[model samples]
Target chain A: MTILVKIFGDLRKKIEGYNISDALPLNLQIESNGIDTIADILNKFSIEKEETYHLFVNGTYSGYNKKVKDGDRVGLFPKNMSLLYKWYFERNEDE
Target chain B: MAKRILRVDMTKLEANFENFPADFAALGGRALTSTIVAKEVDPLCHPLGASNKLVFAPGLVTGTKAPTSGRISVGGKSPLTGGIKEANAGTTFAQKLGRMRIAAIVVEGKHEEDDYYLLKVTNDGTEFIKANKWSNKGLYDVYKELYKEFGDKVSISGVGIAAEIRGAASGICFNDPEGLPSRYAGRGGLGAVMASKGLKFIVVDETGAPGVEILNEEAFNMGVKKLTNALTSHDVTKPGGALNSYGTCVLVNIINEAGGLPQRNFSSGQDDRSEKVSGEVKAEEIKKRGGVRPHFCSPGCVIQCSEVWTKPGGKDPVGVLEFESVWALGPNCSIYDLDVIGELNRTCNDLGLDTIEAGDLLGVAMEGGLLEFGDGKGALKMLNEIKNKTPTGRILANGTAFTAQAFGVTRVPVVKGQGLPAYDPRAIKGIGVTYATTPQGADHTAGYAIATEIMGVGGTADPKDTNKSDLSRNLQLATAAIDAAGYCLFIAFAILDIPEGLEGVVDTLNGVLGASLTVNDVAGYGQQIIDTERAFNKAAGFTEKDDRLPEFFLKEPLPPHNEVFNVSDEELDKVWGT
Candidate 1:
């Protein structure tokens, strides 16, 4: 199974060894593990929780705990690229 | 120097200075404009007729050291909406008016002559110059010539070919810091009201002018410190933040990803090609072309989201390609290339047309079989027709609804005769409520429900929540207060989460007015401004039925989400408790 991952803004520079020339979405081949969530994908890529602000799963705003399966699309935006700080902070407080 | 109002009577060709009314001591910006319009102008008067009055006002904290507070409000009966309109812009022109101690400039009576005139206001007095030589020219060239003639110390506000023809899509153009004719009070066709008065431009020279007076200096300082801290510290507004790095166009990718970015005249939401015109892409292009990014529309703005979009290798700057401008002109018309969008934006600036209205009208023109979608060159030609005052140009310049009716198209995206902004209401239901119920027609800034509906601010989080009447009401009230205070609406993102920031705003107001106004009074102040405008709109024959989105938005299912704007009419009417 493969999950398509897209990184936006300054997050592109943060990922180690990621080719900037390859501007298309990064495909991460994942074994058939039903437990794999967005957090696990971030962990696989070594992206810290603080490094990401907005997360979208399949074009819908989502949380780190949302499960990602094959053929799913996930997009990540960095903290500096944060568009809506209130929602990010408020949702964090609730968590 | 005591604050005063400049009353310019076009019929008599006279300019008079009157002492600022004691009753209006606390009013500025949108508050002052709406109040004066409601009190003086007959609501039923023709918007572009002799009876209409065009008002220009600076905000309460405008000329002061308040960060990001340099905003001006232009108010009058809107030729587009046929309702009371107050359109705001951030520019040094506003700051100049504020420093000059000119609270408001009311332009009344229409000139009987066919010639145009320019009103020149210095610290000494005001003079009228016959400006027929500058009539019918594009603003970009006229602005440079005016600056050369009047010198660098002056700020200008002028109309262009669109206003010369009294186009309903015309907007009042102002100068940026570099004296570029880019900043604008760019909605509701207030420029037509100015043109109908035969007033081409109003130039303000603030040389030797006395600045705004702060009654309570200590409170003002403290408030400024807190608000500045909030703006500089907030993740979304601070240095290196989203706005600072990519400008307002940063939302191109964000909104597109959320499945709310309208494409091809609201026919679809969220196209993959939208990334081609994303803020990140634009920033990269601006950097490569040596264009200016993270630029400010006015001096002293902390959130410098404005930029200069230049052609390849950085020639012929076309000012900022704002998110709404890019969306309306690019993706909404199925034209995704930034270069094409830049030229369209430049033409809009040159001709003094509202980018949103022009883009929406172009989309309608496309649907009406005037041209094919994605024909960027064709769109440019239509804009030129407006410049030439061709018969087809007249219909196009009247705005989206009128253009749609002319073409026999029924899928019109307008409310109160004004075109919708960038957001697609079908996906974001709360903003749909705002587009439906705002007295200013389909203005997104009238009530930016996206902050709460999408971003989870102001206690509402669900985007699809149909019961958003209360949310829209609260946001519209807060927005009115912010507009009156002269702070840019972007500041709301910081102040909403930062408690001290909100307090700081009230403190600054109290410092300026020498009257104690708690945060509790904020809503009431906003309510008063809105109530005044509502009364004017009600008197102007706008019934509850006016507060509605087009039928297409209700029935058509937008792609990606495939959701229609299902917020019931009852829910919409509940926005104002009608």
Candidate 2:
């Protein structure tokens, strides 16, 4: 299955080969194995699911283990963007 | 000395100290200002007249070492909405007022003559000065001149030429941390109210004054510690949080992506060009230009989300370009250039106009075919009209709804006569309820349902939920209390999620006043403040009919999700009732 990953805020710098200045939600298409969760997808990208980052699947927040189907939209934000989203998520200080 | 009230009568050219009345002893900030205005000012009187009184008050916790508590509430009958108004700003003026043990400054009685005066205050006493030398000057120049005359230790609250011309959108400008006249109680035409009294500026010098008296020093310290911990730990209010990194304009992308960004005068929701003026770009630009990204508007602000945006080569520093200001001047006006937006924002500060209202007016003017969309130069030209007081400028200065009416355009997005801020009510239903039902008239801060509806501050509510009146009500009640405490509204980001932070707020108030106020009492206190403002509005002839969004919000379906404001009128009425 193939899914779209959008990185926003400071994490945009982490998305290799993406221009941080070129608009926002720096997009990249990722091919994934069957029924991959958000965590699995980030793992594939070599992106650690750090405590500072918030994951949003489609417009709502999604946990790392939440399953993603084909063409699922995912947004990853740093601590700053997570704070900006004001999305209610427990902070995992162990990051 | 007991807390005092300074009454300045422009008509008599006299400044005198009056004993703080016992009835207002417990009241502070908006709670005191609204109570005084409701009791003294005639509701039906013209807002920019002698019958209307302008009140300045620091919140109960203002002068203490309380983090982000340096907010001042300026209240009066609004010339913009013709209703009770309290617009707040983060400035050292409030800290000075609080340290001096001055509960409130009530400016009443219009000047019979055509001269302007400045009210200067020190710990010793207050004096009125003839300010004719700085007449008709922009606040930037006025602040610089006043700074030179009084030294940098003084805090200034002044008006620009727009206020002198009685522009309905004019707001009282205050000096920021850098002594620039940028921070403002920038809503409801309170500057016009001040200018109507023939007062040009207020200088507060708190040197040699004892700081605010804390009744329970230990309790206050504990409370401050708790709040500070919560603020520093929270992802939002932390030192290097999103707000600190990029300022409030960070929301430009989030809201734009949600299809609720209100573009080109609410004609559309999403604008691809929005990212050009967004926080991501803004932060990058500020860094590239060697500007201060994480700046404080006032002293003791833990959440330094404010910024000082300097021009290329770090030459001229512009004031903070807030998210709403960016939205108003950028996406809403279809002008995507940050440079243009910053210029327009500076014009608003210089002219003492509300940036939100000024931006809304430009959009409305565009909708009325006065300017072309995306024409940044044209928008600047329109603002120049207000500065130059051209006939067109005069009409535009009155604000969005009035400009729409003058142009015979019916698609004005306003409630209770004040223009809507950045949010589109149709796409975000919870805030729509707030925009409709709040006493302050289309004000987003009045009941920022966006916190929950979009940002998930307190609890995530479906933005499209009409039954979330309970959420709006709870937030509104708590917000009133926060406003009364003189804490910056940003503190809500921490306190709403961290229960201890809210308790800390209550503790600070209790320690300040020597009262046994529980956390539960906050809601009730907020309710009382709202009830007071509502009663004033009702007395001023507002009805259930007045607590409504413009007709187009209900009738027109916004794009993307194609949602209309689905909240029933009954649900909106239930906001105050509950």
Candidate 3:
């Protein structure tokens, strides 16, 4: 399954050899034979579990445990954005 | 030690220092300004006439070690909106005033003659200097001349050509750390009020001035320590936070993604060129262009969400490019060219205009077919018209609502005569309640429900939820208190998530005033400020009708989310419940 991913702010530097273009969301086809959460995809990208980042799937803030399907637009932001935006990121809370 | 107040009677051309009134002792910043304006200035008095007064005050902890707490409040009856107004700016001028133990500077009674004057304040005394030489000049030039006369250490606050002409869109400009007149108490045409008094510059020299007297030294230290920890530890306020790294422009992408970024004069919520103008792109460009990133507007600011943007070759240096400035000039006008936005922002500063109002007016003008949408060069040309005070410029200089009325454009996005900011209220429904109900006339910072609805500062509320009147009111109250305290509103981000940080803010106030106030008391203080402002607005002939989003918002559906401002007027009235 393929999903588009974007990273911003400190997360860009955290990524190894991060290209500037990576800041804008680009498609990533991750092998997902089984259903997986955003956390799983982040882990596959070598993102540390303890890292303070906000995840948004399909333009809405999503929990790490939220499922990530193919073609979902996932955005990763540092913990700074959560407070900057007043902790409003978890858009899928109702879901 | 008693605080001092400087009362400058422009009518008499005399300045006097007096003891800060015991009745107004507890107040500072917005609370002080609003309270004074509410009590002193007649609501029905013409804002540009002799009856209106301009009051400048620093926050309680402005001169202290409170991180990001240096903000100055400028309050007066608004010429643009015909309502009470308090516009704030984060500049070293406030800190210098606080250090001098000056509670407020009150400018009253218009000068009989039209000759411009400068109100110069120092530790020695205050004087009115004939400043006609700098009349009708850009603030940047005025700042340079003032800096040369007063020295680099002195703080300068002045108006520009727009204010000299008493343009309704004019704002009082203050010098930043770099002595650039880029920081502004930019709202409600307060600059015009200042100019009406025949005052052009307020140069503050704090040398040999006594610093603020702390009531409780121990509490103050503890409060500073707690706040420092919260600010440093928080991801947003910390050194490597989004603001420090990318500056405020970071929100451009997020808001665009949320489908709330106002584009093309509120005709759309989303723009295809959103990524091009995002903070990420700006930051990247700044880095590539050898511009200064992570710039601080005032001294002792830890967050430093300000930045100095320059042209690609670094030939032309644009003063701090803020998120709102970028959004207003870039996306709302359908112009994504950063250079053009930068130039327009610089022009707004030079002309002593509020970029938000100026950009909104341009957008409305575009809607009126006066200019083509997405024409960056054309936008620049129209701005030049404003600088030259052309007929078209005069109309635009009056601000968004006025321009709309003149052009017979119905899609004007404004509340109470003030233009709506970057976020389209139709999509960001929580903020819509705030825009509709705030006494400040469609100001985002009045309640800032975007924190909860989008950023989740206090608590998460669905962006589409119209049942956020209570949340908006609470945030508005808290913000009032924060504004009064002179703490940068950004501190709310840290204090909201960190309970101790909130306590630290309260403790700072307690230490400064030597009073024991609980967290609940702060809320009460904020409520009192709101009540005072509301009373002033009411006395000024404002009613339930004034607290409303324009009709277009309710009837017209915005793009992406395809949502209208579904918040009911009854709910908006309930924002200030009986």
Candidate 4:
């Protein structure tokens, strides 16, 4: 089973080919196989291991260490976008 | 060599070319403009009065090999804010003026007549051409006539229908590369002042073959190479080249996801239309229409952010579309159509106004029930009234803050009486600090902490934290330096987050000026510039109390994201003082 790893912003370019490339709607397709964690998935894409690249397990922001399930649609994004955020309410005792 | 200053007393109709003082040699753009405003123009004088002086300045590196230094600063007492305002624009014309060795063009006093005229300049000298007939012509047609009469390479700045009516909302339009009257010195009603000077078009035809000569070619070329290389190799500057490819509209989705996207005139922070309004959409549309061409605004521009755009399947593009314009007309008005957004953009360029301010003003009108939310046609109707100078259009022409006040709308996003940019200050707490504290009200580019949050320009920070004070401080300081150089702020996207990038830029500046300046010198110069602007504001009747986000942003908890701007006023007040 393969999962669709969607990247946004700079992350999309860092992991270039894993996207649907077309002039009409610039998209990318990155193959995911044996990528258990978001970290592993990113490693496969040759993305640097940094907290800047936050993961979204289908519209919900997730940790990099979170387990990636087969067929799970992962939306990768930057951590801080604007000063406004719902992620603050996520109860990050460590942060 | 830099150009000599041309001072024009609108009252006396007298003018002379004077050299810039040695002390003012290091200054450019905001620094130069702000200093002139603070020193010469009375801060307490009425913004539209003869006491207020308009300073047009190109940056320190403008005539040199430094990239993207074609930015021109128009500074004066703002009629809308009643405080000092500096609106920056990018164009080849600014460099042409710089090459002409004009450090600054000061327009002071007012003409006796209500009739408008034109100000034309060439490499030899400047001229005030009489043209009361061109007063009410639409900007595009005016630009076409100017290009036809002068030449294609002529850089022209003129007002449109809005300015002739003395709309406090008008701006000066500049011709982009495609010869469209797209780019503008858009903010704080400077165009109306130009019109008040009995002048309309200010054209610089630098066609006489002698380009600006470098005082030290070796140094200038060295600096240009280092900065250009730094820009090309960086991540954001290369593939995710936001400005070159998508322009500023790239922020639509990212801000939406972060929950800072201002929808329908800041009613909410998130726009569901994010997917549609995102930079990806713009890029694709440009590709489909074959309008995806990019060009630098001036000579030696490394980060080519400014571009001429046309309608898909249409030859004439509305204007140079940016993120601010997209938000101002699109989500701000509940209209998500990019074509309509482009039309509104063209309309603003042709009419000579700022897109963000116009959108905010229209949003105020929408709240007043003059038009429904997302009513594209209705918004056009109001803009048309402004073009034609109808009674109602006069109110909308001034700016969003004014419109909000006139209609008793409570949610007007402004600081120091000027309209806010696309970012909702309340949600973006760091930027809120910027919005409140910057001399220019609610200007996103003033500090632009988003460079870190979105693209990690300098470095990534917790955008959600109200304690991102340090980041805000650094960004504000750095941005001031960047603005002074007259380089597009987008250049930071590549330079920051890269090592030796600062060193490279420093190398170029040293080369251009033949002065051995360091990175610390840049920071110090930036601080001095900020200090000057702050002092100007202080003397101009601003208090520490004026450094504040709108009252509602602090109190109101927005939906979709139940967060308020939690940054304390004390923290904001300490921004520059610290």
Off by over 4 Å in 2: A1-4, A18-24, A31-43, A46-74, A83-95, B449-466
For model 3, how does the per-residue alpha-carbon lDDT over B241-358 read when each residue is reduced to its tens digit? 8788878888887787677889999988887587787787888788888888888888888889888888888766767888888999989999988888999999899999999998
Worst 10 residues of 3 chain B by lDDT: B449-458
lDDT of 1 by residue, A18-95 (tens): 775443334444553653788887787688988887777776677788777788877887876666422312121112
Q: TM-score of the second chain in each model? A: 0.98, 0.97, 0.97, 0.94
Count of residue pairs whose backbone atoms collide, per candidate: 0, 0, 9, 23
> For residues B1-578, what per-residue lDDT tens digits would candidate 2 score against the true structure?
78999998888988898999887767999999999999999999999889999999999999899998999999999999999999999999999999999999999999988899999999888888999888777777878889999999999999988888898899999999899888999999999999999999999999888889898987888889888887888877898787777789878877775567899899887775787888888888888889888899988999998998767867567779999899998899999888888888988998999999998988989989998988989998998898888989889988998899889788898888888888787766777787888889988887741243322234344433436577677677777888899898888778766878877887888889888887767767888999999999999999999988888998888886587888788888888773
Question: Can you tell me the DockQ of model 3?
Answer: 0.37
For candidate 3, the TM-score of chain A alone versus the native chain A is: 0.68
TM-score of 2: 0.93
Q: Pick the candidate with the highest lDDT.
A: 1
Q: What is the interface RMSD of each candidate, in Å?
A: 4.7, 5.4, 3.9, 6.4
Q: Report every candidate's CA lDDT.
A: 0.87, 0.83, 0.82, 0.71
Give the root-mean-square deviation of each candidate in angstroms: 2.8, 3.7, 2.9, 4.6
In model 1, which regions exceed 4 Å deviation? A19-35, A84-95, B449-466
- Alpha carbon lDDT of residue B297, candidate 3? 87
* Predicted structure 1, TM vs. truth: 0.95
DockQ comparison, 2 vs 4, better candidate: 2
